[model samples]
Target: MVSPVAVPGGAVLGSAFAWGHGVNLRRLKYFVKIVDIGSLTQAAEVLFIAQPALSQQLATLEGEVRQQLLVRTKRGVTPTEAGKVLYRHAQIILRQCEQARVDMEAAGEGLSGQVSVGLAPGTAASALSLPLLRTVRARHPGILLYLNENYGTTLSELIMNGRMDLAVLYGDKAIHGLSFLPLLKEPLFLVGPRAMPAPAQPVKLADLRDIELFLPRPYNVVRKLVDAAFVRAGMVPRVVAEIESAFTLTAAIADGLGATILPASMAREVVAACGAWQFQIVDPVIEAPLALCQSDHLPLSEPAQAVKSILLELVVDLAGTFAATPEPELAALS
Candidate 1:
């Protein structure tokens, strides 16, 4: 990852401006990392550097931002109000540099090469990624696919290492070394065996306490939100088992192992297979935003750009069609 701090303090490509004294792109990036992990120690570990060096960078960033960016506490450090706003802006600035790299690479390649992509669980393989994937396959056959499922943080590391060319993932949680382009926001739905009875209309959040449920392991974004909903509803989930594979989890739900909370987009295909399991939008609703991600350090190959372009076009189409589809709680997103 190109650190924002790595740029010369006074370097200006287009405009004469002072970012900060002794500050560069890398430090600002470090600041963003601290905000995301909410801990100097964890961020340092991820960066694989000494804790003292990371802390020094944070101090430099805070001074440059001219505000108290983080609030220290027993658990971890959290960004202050101003800090949160700056983090978002920093992300935008960093992404522009990445896009520039993409553009430069695109200029020479003339659109014909391969890019292996890693799909974060729900992002690349569901109805959301299906159209984009199909379009890429049809329109850019030369591009090789190294499609695989992964967690958000894990995928980001792969992207950084150049193991994967790009990815589609949930965006609330930040991952370094990747640029996230917000595509569309989608909601989650409570899915259960159709053979099992359901309330007349959509069920309230509070109604799920006693129901036997099956859900993904805790790292899943949907699972986290589902757990939070249960907490808000003044109940705990009656989770009988947890599984990571969607095929296995859906199969379990279809076989009547238990009910599970899944994104509307992913639940769509499974519903047909569940024979008896039905799904409904839960009240006190939650929505997850999915985004397209690409490696910041590596220049995309020609075929990668073609596939990415087609995928982008497909994503635009899906976002429009998704708005009209009511059956699936989630709309297609890339």
Candidate 2:
């Protein structure tokens, strides 16, 4: 029987050499596959290995580090606390190794490396997705791409911790170890169901006080901006509920539960999805600044640099096509 162990604080229990020599890249990759597929059988089938052999390897991996990495239940396999930590670091290690191979193979070719990027959910769902992926595939097939869609704060934290090479997120207060490159200012819009009567003119920010609102929770950066704007306008918004998921928020608005504020791009998406109409918010013309951010503590890897350059170029080209107002300055916010 494999001995059961619990991880506390994610600290490695064994000595440095013990942890170092006991594990190999193959085992780490196998472990990650198992976690991703959520079943040893599925992972083995995908890896073209026997189930028993995969089980034995997992046992060996567990015994070497003397830590229980996965918890097997009737449903499937899930990573334990230690396994989660190992998985995150293993992803970085595997990518680095792949990058090294790509670099060697590229003797006289163009740039070859992996760039892991994090993007805010709204940004990821916008028109930028297709063009970004296509550009990378066409221009630099040697470079591997990994894209993660998350919230602004989550993306910022990932980039700062070295997990994500770059991210596009809303600029909040100054983050100490990251540099923010201003991208474009996104205007806020009020959305409601199509059946609702459209306002004759732009809805003033102060006028929002009369409308029942269903917005993201206070923890979200967008919600914070909305609340601050309301305070500045000297009116308290009638928030009916606090929702976190954008889809749920938009659906609620379409169902006539309450209206919500969203960036222009996101508002358009919801409008199309639920036959909703978006009204431009005016009076103060509130807008949020989107930025392309990266860690300032470390120099970007060659592949990361290449990806950044391509991304900047694509954003500029697309912004011009959309006639967007941009503040494209690579200024470090202190």
Candidate 3:
């Protein structure tokens, strides 16, 4: 067992020695905690250690690196470029080492585990969710998935709260204490009653000024991007209704109620409906970027990592297919 005393460099414990000594896992843990919370005192409280001790360990690490890793700000201590770099490398090394240990013990055991997954409402059923489910089912039959879907804000909160193991979202800002890896950029589309006619190709924002629209409530990531384009065109959107369900919204559009601007993922069945139609939202074209977010404290288990890898593979496949065929060609199919 590694004794507490075996941990080198107190406070910022691992920061003292230069390139040549035994690895100090405890000190590295301290440095990572400080970086995550952005303050030595907060990091101390969380780690159940004293502030002075944390400070001393950090100071010692600075000595070894021969550079300040963080700078005191009014809000908290922000990462110095050096500190940021170290934090990244430390995280990678820590995760790799942990994975190595697990692999050594397991010797490639069968995948039989449970991972609770989350999906933001917007990304829940799209490429992120669908392809991932297929791959998981085929490759890791023994793995059980506990899945839930919700709005982006709520999903991010769930990951932070440990209510979820992982979440697929389309984030505009980096959530604190979680790691987000962008997977794909899903296109934006203008959906209307199937009878509603759009041009053979993409339509301009200014031209849609008189059209009535139904969409998810304002303030959502996609809505904001849509609003910005309308603002630039000096037009106010004529809102017909606010809806959450793409299925319901599609039904409404197909019934000739009103049109909607939505992610390509949401517009799928709606596009195929006889009465409803779809077109690309262009000029300043915008796409929602799908992301995978995981808790820093709860490093991804092997099963969770398998899901992530499958998600990325699908994203890569989509990218390659899109690159070979331009949007102009695909939108014409509708």
Candidate 4:
């Protein structure tokens, strides 16, 4: 029998044949797959193993952990409380195992592996997608970069599950399993069509009360900030529609449908591309917070670390340029 091997996070991996004493990687994989599919028979079909064999493996796993991990029902199987906890750890463990293999294979050679980075929509980081892709390609040809543009909450969930390596998203709120590195505080701007007369000065929160607006759903980080500001001012915004896609929002704005509030960088880009205009918000200026987020418990692989370094460098460069530009300069561009 193979000896028990200690992995990161103080977890032990031993032979699957160790039976009632130790849980092995293969069994953990089976358990995770079964939970993910929510059916043992289906999992067996997908795993190309007999149903009885998969059931036996799960029994052995439960015995090793001394916990009931699943509940069977007519609908499907669901993880028990203990199973839920184990499922989270199992995801991290599997991801670490894969990373270990990649690290070992690339040892002594230059860094090379796939790194998945998420950039939340409606934030300045979303604009970095192309730049990041180009930079990674130029710097590390061996690295495969996967960029996901999504909502902050979705990206954070992926990071917590160990499915994504890192993300640049709005919000500095403390999440349980994630760590945030605050990048910059971006002032919000009121962006609208050029057909509408541009404001000579910064617009106030109360001033936007009558203006029809196109905003993301209430759950969005930017939307929450805007809503809180409105509530503080004792005013209700006139929201014509809830739009999540930047393209769709911009299209609506270009069609003279409504205005939108966005961070400075994203606002600038939107106005420049759609022939729109933007002015900063005032009378209690609202700012959206941006941060780099990663798993608090898991370690980054070499490729991920390298990509993160490059991301930081790019953020610094972008922020410096943005900071140097004054409101007057922004107005001129608008």
User: In TM-score terms, which candidate is top?
Assistant: 4
Q: Each model's TM-score?
A: 0.60, 0.69, 0.61, 0.86
Off by over 4 Å in 2: 1-101, 320-323, 330-334
Better of 1 and 3 by lDDT: 3
The runs of at least 3 residues in candidate 4 whose Cα sits more than 4 Å from the true structure, single-residue gaps closed, are 1-20, 320-334
Q: After superposition, how far is residue 95 of candidate 1 from its true place, in Å?
A: 20
Model 4 alpha-carbon miss at residue 83, Å: 1.3
Clashes of 4: 0
Task: Quote model 3's TM-score.
Answer: 0.61
lDDT tens digits, residues 76-168, model 2?
Answer: 999987677667666756766666787788768887777887778764225666777898899888778988888878888787656789988
In the order shown, what is each candidate's alpha-carbon RMSD? 10.2, 6.2, 9.5, 5.6
Best by lDDT: 4
Candidate models: Cα lDDT each: 0.67, 0.75, 0.69, 0.83
Error of 4 at 181 (Å): 0.4
Poorest 10 consecutive residues by lDDT, candidate 2? 1-10
Candidate 4, poorest ten consecutive residues by summed lDDT: 324-333
Better model by TM-score, 3 or 4?
Answer: 4
Error of 3 at 20 (Å): 32
